[model samples]
Target chain A: MSGRSHDIPEEVQVLAGEYVLGALDEAEMLAVRRRAAADPELAAAIAAWERRLAPLADAVPPVAPPDELWARIAAAVAPVPQEAAERPPLHAPAEPLVPWARPVRPPPRRIWPWQLATAASLALAAGLAAFALLPRPVPPVEMAALTPPDAAAPGFLVTARPDGSVVLTAAAPAPVPAGRDMELWVLPKGASAPASLGVLPASGMRMVLPTPPAPGTQIMVSLEPKGGSPTGKPTGPVLYAGTFGALSP
Target chain B: MADARTADEPTALLRQVAAGDRVAFRRLYDLQAPRLYAVALRITRQGPLAADAVHDAFLQVWRNAGRFDAARGPAEAWLLGLVRYRALDIARRGGREVSADDLDLPEPADDGPDALEVLAGSRDAAALHACLRQLEAERRRLVLLAFVDGLSHSEVAERVGMPLGTVKSWIRRSLQSLRLCLEGAA
Candidate 1:
């Protein structure tokens, strides 16, 4: 930011340029986006570039999409009807509607180098004084970074203690809309369903779990209705997820 | 395009889409999907992924159409941005990067001055097309390949056979110059 070029900084200009040219990977894009959101000048620069380069799209030849493509899009975008606060169904449901979704491994995520770099910058900046506050990682104290599959930036970092307690800390949390809350879920090995691990603390929180999870257990955060998902299962898309692993040596 | 509606129809259709008008949404998809799909296809190089990008983009447009203020830019530009982001993401998620040489499709025949001006109908598009024409040939090609084909800085450097630093500088300069030209033209 110091020793700037003209009025705006050179690195920011480069960021806006990279964003427009699509030269940046997700991690860089995310970093620029976080900045542009707060800085109007950067946003204006980006918008101008988007407008200027938009015409280049004319050169691309239009190809017809598949016949059923519209159907798929329509189904995906249909608004989820709001639940009635007071009125129960006229007829009692025959059974509980707990959907048994197979917790399939999500597509391999693209963790951009810059995203890792951002997190590493934080850890390095903290140095020893910060490390003094953090618990020592012993044989049973494992940590994991929970990054959502669709995320462009960093995600939450969690350190699990051998005594079934965990400290969940937010790195770059995915934004949740108003009237919505982020719910954490744990899918332990050999479990048929994901157990609710309470809401993710905005900053960071330490909570004792009923049992210590095994290594390699997957952790997920989903955007649920206000409070949490009405159903026991995830009613919304899983925004961020990552598996548990040993702390960095 | 098939219906001979004015260029403004896309903006109108998007407004309707925001209101949950399914039929209007269908027409919007019919009108714009091909171009969006083509953009995605160019970047993803796979039919399924390209289709997914388009589908995801349209859904995003439907959900966020209300946020589209025509005053910002054209509907086509807005929609194209969505699809372009989606396509780039798909390419990255699949760990698939296609160099210029690896592409099997023929390059856009009009990779020169007035490449975009001929099709431009809006003042912004026309201004941009003119500004692009002012850039040097190599810088323009770099911009096109990077934006259109969704190549990264390193990929563009390898494709253009230039050093990475040179590519970055040219792109940064090209962007600044283009912004200046467009503003002056306006």
Candidate 2:
């Protein structure tokens, strides 16, 4: 047999320890991350060390972050309703409120989290409070009310325009199975098969269409795998259907 | 089993999130963000930076939840690992500002056996406690400083007044021993 062995090199294990211990410098840390990607033994060692040191976290006391922090994180993760995002941020700094006062300071070298959190939080809140006063976006050109197969009440409301822009709001979302996704499809009149739009967001809104489905097209939604269907077509049960119509508010 | 349960619930929630389940993502966020924010706060020592780290980490969680492998490690460790790395990245980039004197030094009793004992709430925690206790007091103290305080090896060396090389070797050996200890070697 060749001289290969199963044990992770002692150097690899030590680096893994240092990586999990938060002791590696940036270069070393990046090197370790890169190496672990191609080295299963090294990856396993790193995971093991992370488990060993996980308990150390119990010592640090938790600090409640700014309430606005959640909104920021949620906005980062979910697709922000495009219409809400497009409206000009209520006010421009036509005049600097305080030319000297920066809402978020560039972190000082000797930064302190509690004090900085307080200052940044106040600035954020003031900015949001002001921004909330701005007017809402112009309403969509058309609306489609999605109805479920056997239900009388509409299940969703889709607001869209001729530009292929859409905002689908689920009035009542079904329980999506853990491994499945909800997909949107559109069938313009004279098209033999429905064309795929994309996967629907589990809640809130999902935007689809590069070009608005031709006017008078029928839109349907179905459940599929988490990444949407592999065949570029819906392969699961059709859940809801709605037809586009002119509606302006 | 308790430790696995501690991680499995989040793993399941993340799975749902990978499938684009916003409700599950929010549930997972509620479950982990406090500690994550606190961890980032300690490491970055800037609230805005901490918030950035948490924001970036959860964004990755939402985007990459599909890749989490439960068999490779616990979900809590994976989630914390993401934030820890991001916070460390931020701290490293702001290296010019991180003066040694500015560190929030660990309290004298934090690494004490009693304090560590209180951490024995999960199987990994219990095993870690047993292994950590076997290290000589100084190395145990150093490990706590490096991990809990998020100190670099040089920073730990400077704080402990040891040569940088000496600190590195001692910590490496300490980690090696701890790994062996948890593997049931006496």
Q: Tell me the lDDT of model 2 at A87.
A: 61
What's the true lDDT of residue A229 in model 2? 76
Pairs that collide, model 2: A109-B97, A164-A212
Backbone collisions counted per model: 1, 2
Name the weakest run of 10 consecutive residues (lDDT summed) in model 2 chain B: B95-104
Off by over 4 Å in 1: A1-14, A79-249, B1-5, B98-124
Model 2: runs farther than 4 Å from truth? A1-6, A80-249, B1-7, B95-115, B121-123
Backbone clashes counted, model 1? 1
Residue-wise C-alpha lDDT for candidate 1, range A1-249, written one tens digit per residue: 212224766566667878977998777777878988999878766765666677777777788865435544553444333442233532232222211111122212222112222332333223422332234322434687777775566477777643334667678886679898888777654454676655564665565442334455667888888877777578898987777654456
Q: Residue B186 lDDT in model 2?
A: 20
Worst 10 residues of 1 chain A by lDDT: A98-107
